[model samples]
Target: MNVFRLFEERVAGALGRLADAGDIPAGLAIGRVVVEPPRDPSHGDLATNAAMVLAKDAKTNPRALADKIAADLRGDERVAKVDVAGPGFINLTLAPGVFLDVLRAAVAAGADFGRGGVDGPKVNVEYVSANPTGPMHVGHGRGAVFGDALANLLVFAGRDVTREYYINDAGAQVDVLARSAFLRYREALGEDVEIPEGLYPGDYLKPVGQALLATHGPGLLEQKEEAWLPVVRDFAIDAMMDMIRADLAALDIRHDVFFSERALSRGETDHIAATIADLRARDLVYDGRLPPPKGQAVEDWEDREQTLFRATNFGDDVDRPLLKSDGSYTYFAADIAYHRSKFERGCPEMIDVWGADHGGYVKRMQAAVRAVTEGRGELDVKLCQLVRLLRAGEPVKMSKRAGDFVTLREVVDEVGRDAVRFMMLYRKNDATLDFDLAKVVEQSKDNPVFYVQYAHARCASIFRQASEAFPGEPFGPQALLAADLARLSDEAEVEILRKIAAFPRLVEGSAHAHEPHRLAFYLYDLASSFHHLWNKGKDQPHLRFVNQTERESTLARLALVHAVRCVIAAGLSVLGVTAPDEMR
Candidate 1:
């Protein structure tokens, strides 16, 4: 029932027939050929670039090739008219019946109308891997929503996707967390302790200290610093992970795999060392020294030989260091090991959702993927920019519990998860967003989540009225499939029908481009179209969706409304937003 896909197959068929007739060439590539909506609706219903894309390959003039393609399309029973527009674009206007048939299929599918049928290798999407040291802040929520929505979109579009989270439990931050919790543990044992500079001062550690005291009963207080630090750090990491998981649950995000960085080097597997040895065996590693820093006195720069990866050979701007001057593996070495783990798990395509500060790190990591996977794996990183929280245009204060930044759970609890998720995705990921707390809950067009959800609720209201107008008529999606919808010839109704037919194409495009914002934009536009049609029905009595005197016309309009409802629900499901049945 995908109209665009149908046209693509039809266009390819026309090209094959031309080859069979010896029109130009037989092996003209059609990969570049595409079928999409016409830029100008007045031009036609569907547009294709097959002629322009294939002309040079076939050694034919562009306009002449377009004419031949248009002639072949004119022979299609569904095509009402075919025209060759400027240079080589072929626009085909399908008969009205074709659109109506597509509408029937859409209604019959209900909430599953936009599910696609693509096939590919498994994809691993790692996101929200905030260091397991504290509660999630608002910035982490943005990456969490983006990754979850993208994974949902890929699943809807028929891709095998795996949601993963990388736990950074091996860094200096965890050591600091252990010391910070030690202070709180003393306070829990009735000793006054003041948090010193360079130590965490958040009240969140109080619960961790209480939990530690409950488990060990002050035995750890007598142990030396080195003896208790590891035990306390492990305990604190688990507690923080519990809090982070709870925060993500509020937004309906769950990761399938929680890979730990400590596990990379703690057990029998020192993956970072193993990866470096493999690269060295392949001659991709070397003992090298980078040039002195720019605009610096050469004497001030230390001369040291470091273990380096030949990253520039794979596409990076410069060769990167794998070991620090202290002879320890760098963070980049651990990351390369992590991505290699993904490839070994049978995922060649991987995506990382990182904060905006990591924008400069993307290229080097991608280069390492090439060197480690030996061109067998690829990595794509999406950077989410900072979110500025506002309440009625004024900055909100930090959370007392977190001590510095506001917790993600606080925002979701204030305005509901639906508002937080929808507004986070309402803008592109790389753009800095100004989130207004007071504006998202307003019941108006300015609140896109409310506007879209209200559109679904309005559809429910229309069905209730239709039931009263026609007491014995069945108005479910399946029953509406039998409706004689030809009576929906009005311009406004047809506009809605067109919008519903475009859902599958929109879903496919958004998933392929790894952009979920496109789905949000499409949903808002569809909601506006439905709302406009309903307002028009108020002024034109005959256009009313429920009229006892015109049973046939009423059923036709109701069928259209049902399709609109189904599409909006499908779209909201992808974005993790609720399409409510009632607004008030």
Candidate 2:
């Protein structure tokens, strides 16, 4: 149950009563009224800006309105006290029974305690569209983890989410990969080969080459470039995709769909051509000459009429070229067609997770989405910043296996998948993250993954101790749910309940914002509060969860512990991290 939402409804009812009583003008807008946790916990359990938001519209003083609202709220059975703070804000302190009810709800809901209430639209999340040139790197891993976690969050929040990856197989990079694999194939045939410049030099292509040699042997060695390029390109891309899939599997990331760029042109539909034709019929595409791009001088810059999309009309800085000087479709053109395909698949809500370098491309892509979907589709692009992998404050330069850069697998192997996933999501997607290998694994409060996992583990340990202390008494969730929770009257114990009760609200907010980091932060805060309570019990034996003398209080406290464990497990599941019963 969402206490904040319940209170918000009550507050709205009070405002309606005021309107009927003629204490305030009729039909004052109350849509913006919000009830949430107070900025300072010491002030009250919840705070609302209803008075401040409606004061001017109702032609009433904010403080006077707040006083009236507070007076009305005090009549609520669930509201223990209500006070006006800072001229207009109304702060509410909930009754003790309310907090007890939250704990019981959490236990009853179990793993689904924090699941969101709103049923949102179907969504398509596209991320980790790394070029099929090699295995994924650290930056790609960040996007993968972030996107996967976001998909999980949306599903938990009651949205139909499709996790997708757009393969860049129809680009120049894949051609280079084909050539590189050919070199490896030649090497497999016992011929020494040197990889030329502008081609991939990583050893990962060696396997693709060996596979081609095993299948075709020396037959392909004599073919012309045109004859072999297509066959070799398809084989090389498939092998590289296998490698990429394995890398993602190492981090527990799986995509529901792997869309191919080549399919846009090769499929029976010819989506790219059809998209251009559709836009041209709508007068959105035309042959036009674009001025030279600003701040860059090109000796070969030519202003010639070419097929262009009316990106400028849709809010882009310039009308973007659809066909290149070579007559092939530009990357932007393919992207527009790809997004149109998503819309055609009935996903009006699309989210693309791109790297920070693509910041300038957001507006144009969004504009294209709007045009193609007839203003019915919405696209939100989340740009993930670079990850600086460090060790004890020193920059980590190279991977153990990947020659030039740190590969995702190597990082996962070195520090583990849990550390990588949690650290990747512990910050805002747009903010650069510093992932220190030495720091994240530390068994201290500074390490959020460890702290949160330990909280779950601590709950398990408490339950085991409770089983021994209460020998023969059932300590499962159902038994705890039947406990007399009124025994949980301590301020610290009630505070923990308050935090646990906020999980549903937190899930709703994070899912609506498309921000998984908020959930990560919330888990950390919950773990911190739980750990503080555990430490408190060290000094005050009465606060200990397993009390030898008081059976009723011990059962109530154990119920609280179970609630904490449930919420942490649910949050960690959204992040694709394990909530260990015991940490090794």
RMSD of each: 1.4, 1.3
Q: Which regions in candidate 1 have their CA more than 4 angstroms from the true location? A: 293-300
Candidate 1 lDDT for residue 150: 97
Q: State the lDDT at 333 in candidate 2.
A: 95
TM-score of each: 0.98, 0.98
lDDT score of residue 420 within candidate 1: 94
Predicted candidate 1 versus true structure: per-residue lDDT over 336-392, tens digit per residue: 999999999999999999999999999999999988889989898999999999999
The Cα local distance difference test for each model comes to 0.92, 0.92
Give the local distance difference test score of model 1.
0.92
Clashing pairs in 2: none
